[model samples]
Target: MIATSEISPIATLSMQISAVLVWLGLVFLTSNILHRFKQDPELVRKVVHIGTGNVLLIAWWLHFPTWLCVSAGVTFSAIALASHYISVLPMLNDVGRKTYGIFYYALSITILVALLWDRFPEYAVIGVMVMSWGDGMAALIGKRFGKHTFVHMGNKRSLEGSFAMFVTSAIVMVIILVLANGFRFRDLGVVIPVAAIAAILEAFSPGGTDNISVPLSSAFLSYLLESTL
Candidate 1:
């Protein structure tokens, strides 16, 4: 971990701002390219979404300060909110509903970085990874191979999608926990329950709300499990 004392405040702020700008630019460019090619907008959106979340792994790996991560999250959220209002990024807003998911997604990222970055950074990464890989795969698989469906809160969900979410989440959490906390029977205890909860939340969450629900739930469960152990 990089000591807070090692990084000057100005340097941290500049780095954070630059990273956010680059990320936003990439999102804008990628969206336009996908549109130009007449690609599957939903798939492209989820790919970008998952990629955006996973990029935090670079920050975590580099031992960025929590404040820097929080700043990036805030900056990203502001831009997303502006885009939502003005339709500046049509690809991101190409979803079925008019919602504040981008805002909520940014909020969740900020919360995880602020709360878990210092003490349990691995958990933070795990939470976001589940949101990224698990959620992303579920949507992709659900759309392509979702024949058996059920309705939840006026939204259609598929058993295949939920299974995808659960399996992916479980695999991610288990691997991360094993690497970070060591492979033990106790770790399995934590992994199973957390993955199940995350999958359920994703299944029930309507529209873009899963952006908030999945990571938050996974982070909370991971924290609780770690605290007890």
Candidate 2:
């Protein structure tokens, strides 16, 4: 892996610019296209949710500097916050809905990148992917196929949704572990517990805070468990 410092100034700038373009293109174009088609706003939200999270893959592949990732997170968190009031990302925030999922999502990314990018980026990937795939799929599946329901902290959730979260979290954890440590059955010790914890957190967290709780817990727990192995 080429160190970020060794890359020439022009190359670094180019990469940063490319990152910005990709992110903006994804957000703006998706919102506009979904709006134009008059698709379900929820669909637009989920598409953006899953799509934007893939930027982490880009960051990981490109070896984005910690500051760049953190700055993007902070910037988007601010945008998400502003979007709560103004109609600034209509596809993301539903009108008159009290949910800060988008904000928490960005903040979690910021926190994970700041904490783990330098020494353990794979953990950061595990964290964000769990949130991106796990929670995103849980919401989608819950909305579509959530037949059995229960309420927690005044928030209703479906068993199907929770199961989706757990399964996705486990799959994400396993994939990252396999990529990072090769195929090892012992990693199941890490994947199972961490995925269960992620599911628990997602089920209990109310008002979309699961975005923060799920990823941070999954990543850090994975880190701790892997250390023991």
Candidate 3:
């Protein structure tokens, strides 16, 4: 039944048209972004390989059970993020730079799958925020202004980038929560704490692929807090 109450012609058409335009832009602009790191073929391969799977996985998260979906998504991403240490840990060269893209794809897809399968749409948005906005900012800032170095768990990373990631990720999560609640920011009870925990993970995680870990870890931490408090 095509209910008149559910249909807004202008709004629907505008959103559809805008979505199409955004898709087209991404299709073409991806090449330019790839070109920036064209000299690094291995990195490109890893990025493309991971991205291929990740994007598809994320798209499938809209139909799952809420809590379980997010929990599974977090678990999957945590595995991917923690996997490298147990495997042949590589150097954080351009190779490492590209590694993040793959990690992002993997974790993003995991969460997306969880969202779709578990009907946990809330976590899906959270996952994407950590991946796209948080991860992206970390790398960009790390490359541009990262000078202060720190070693943790046998990994070399920067404090400046850590701060950037923490602030950016927290802001994104908070903004998402605010907007999700119709700008009623006061209703953000546990989400605010969860976002804060996520920021801390963003600042301290040595995975180099914090994108992979952030969403999954945040989700799990959310579950933990919800259970205890």
- The candidate scoring highest on lDDT is 2
TM-score of each: 0.86, 0.91, 0.56
lDDT of each: 0.81, 0.84, 0.52
By TM-score, the best candidate is: 2
Residue 59, candidate 2: alpha-carbon lDDT: 81
lDDT by residue (tens digit), candidate 3, 1-229: 1232354766544444454346535633553366465644333333433333333233332222244335554654565466545442232234533345344645665655554435444445656565556555665666578899776765555777666666666676566555434565443555666666665666566545555567776655544554565
| Candidate 1: residue pairs that collide | none
Over the full model, what C-alpha lDDT does candidate 1 score relative to the true structure? 0.81
Question: Which pairs of residues collide in model 2?
Answer: none
**Model 3 accuracy (lDDT, Cα):** 0.52
Q: After superposition, how far is residue 72 of candidate 2 from its true place, in Å?
A: 1.3
Clashes of each: 0, 0, 11
In candidate 2, position 68 carries an lDDT of 82
